[model samples]
Target: MQDVISKLVKVQELEMRATKVSASDAEVIKALRKGIPDPILAHYDRLRIRGKKGVAIIRNQVCTSCHMGVAIGTIVTLKQGKDIQLCGSCGRYLHLPPEPASETAVAMLPAKPKRKKRAAVRVPDAS
Candidate 1:
């Protein structure tokens, strides 16, 4: 699962780079494509043909490509890395980026104490 997604991402990157420069990376793209399953590669090619990204990142449980909210089940599946998940809205492959190590460490730390509110002071009224 993860392996396939990683390869797909790499292929996408290479293709993007290839488009920018005159030099071609056909060999590398060909090699990466060989690792992916035919059906998956076909779908990816189809999306590319339409001038869209084949792989999309899932951020804050939303599809970055289509800017649509993704289902919780799909997020869970992506996190589990048990299988490939696609965005229902755009039909693009969904990949949940791994949490940063600092974030995980921060989450484990105890929360800071909240500040207390000050009581209002009373003032004498002039007659």
Candidate 2:
């Protein structure tokens, strides 16, 4: 799935770069389309009809195209790049770029600060 999306994005970039879609570009697209499942290809077609990008990068846990926050669990899966994941908000395909090891380590090192307990005060009897 990831491979298909990458190829599709590359095709899109090529199309954007050239004023007209060349024969080679069409062949690349055709080959890539052949490998993608019909359902997903249909979904991609629908998204294009709606004037939305078919592939969106997951940055800061947000869909770059839709500018919507993605679910934490979905982000986790995307980070691993094991399976194809869709944005919960706009249903656009999601991709996660590799992060540096230092950044990953820093992200994992932070622990939530504990809340301080409030001191209890005895109030004078107001009876």
Candidate 3:
């Protein structure tokens, strides 16, 4: 959540810098009000089981990242919004990026994560 807000502030700052928008105190307040809470998710459905460092991973029905089934207590915490939690698995970052603006904010944008693997894969496979 804090990360999302910080990113938004950076974006706003960049925009102001790019243009000559001298943000006023009132405008600043408005921008703060518009501060992003969940930059990737609009609603609370953004919760996802992602593995992270420190926590134990579950296997089988466990987390893909952690390889452990999330505990009941942790599950409760995830749904209840106690605090930022990580998966017991792979330690990769969890949570979804804030939901983009439905109609206007983003349009004709690619929905795929770009990768530099093409060049890497182009190399002949070492037998």
Task: Tell me which of candidates 1 and 3 scores higher on lDDT.
Answer: 1
Off by over 4 Å in 1: 20-24, 101-127
Model 1 TM-score (2 dp): 0.74
For candidate 1, what is the lDDT?
A: 0.78
Q: What is the lDDT of residue 49 in candidate 1?
A: 94
**Top candidate (lDDT):** 1
Q: List model 3 lDDT by residue over 42-69, tens digit each.
A: 3212322221122222233244543444
User: Lowest summed lDDT over 10 consecutive residues: which window, candidate 2?
Assistant: 111-120
How do these models rank on TM-score, best leading? 1, 2, 3
Residue-wise C-alpha lDDT for candidate 1, range 1-127, written one tens digit per residue: 8889989998998887655633357787888899999999999999999999999998776789978777666666666789998777788998778887553333334443322332235767878
Candidate 3 deviant stretches above 4 angstroms = 1-61, 93-127
Best by TM-score: 1
Model 2 lDDT, full chain set:
0.68
lDDT agreement with native, every candidate = 0.78, 0.68, 0.38
After TM-score superposition, the amount by which residue 104's alpha carbon in candidate 2 deviates from its true location, in angstroms, is 3.1
Clashes of each: 0, 0, 22
Model 2: how far residue 47 lies from native, Å:
0.7
